[model samples]
Target: MAESEHSSSENASMDSIEEHSKQDSELEFSDDEETLIIRMFNLVGERWSLIAGRIPGRTAEEIEKYWNTRYSTSQ
Candidate 1:
């Protein structure tokens, strides 16, 4: 029971996708973003847009729309 409560509290702390991100995670990425981003964007498709700071000048709205459009069509 204690463990379950702890896990729930941990999950609650993740207010947004930002929760999944940490400064350390950024360091894990290679300096060569171009080569890496292409593969990620391909796999994630429109969802890639939701990822902040992935590409300069790409707004959250634009990314959200891209993903929502894809999501609606698939449904």
Candidate 2:
């Protein structure tokens, strides 16, 4: 009886952990994608030249070319 109770508790904990892990993974993925889209928009939207300046080693021209390529392929 004691062993059964312990086993049940362990199972419950494991199930909870698994559920939380799944939720964490989903939230992380969504946040990452949202961040990427926001960055791409901010880079290409108004004040683009300033943002391009903010990121060293990256030029507005190259960024524009990258976006154009992405736009062409995504369609």
Give the winner by TM-score: 2
Q: Compared with the true structure, what per-residue lDDT tens digits does model 1 show for residues 1-75?
A: 999999888778765556556532433434454454545567775555545367665555654554455445565
Residue pairs with colliding backbones in model 1 are none
What lDDT would each prediction earn against the true structure? 0.54, 0.59
User: What ranges in model 2 sit over 4 Å off?
Assistant: 30-32, 35-75
- Show model 1 residue runs off by greater than 4 Å: 1-50, 73-75
Q: Please, what are the lDDT tens digits per residue for candidate 2 over residues 1-75? A: 999999999999999999988744533323444455458676667444554565555555644554455454566
Per-prediction TM-score:
0.29, 0.42
Superposition error at 33 for model 1 (Å): 11
Q: Roughly what TM-score does model 2 have, to 2 decimal places?
A: 0.42
Q: Evaluated with lDDT, which candidate comes out highest?
A: 2
**Predicted structure 1, TM vs. truth:** 0.29
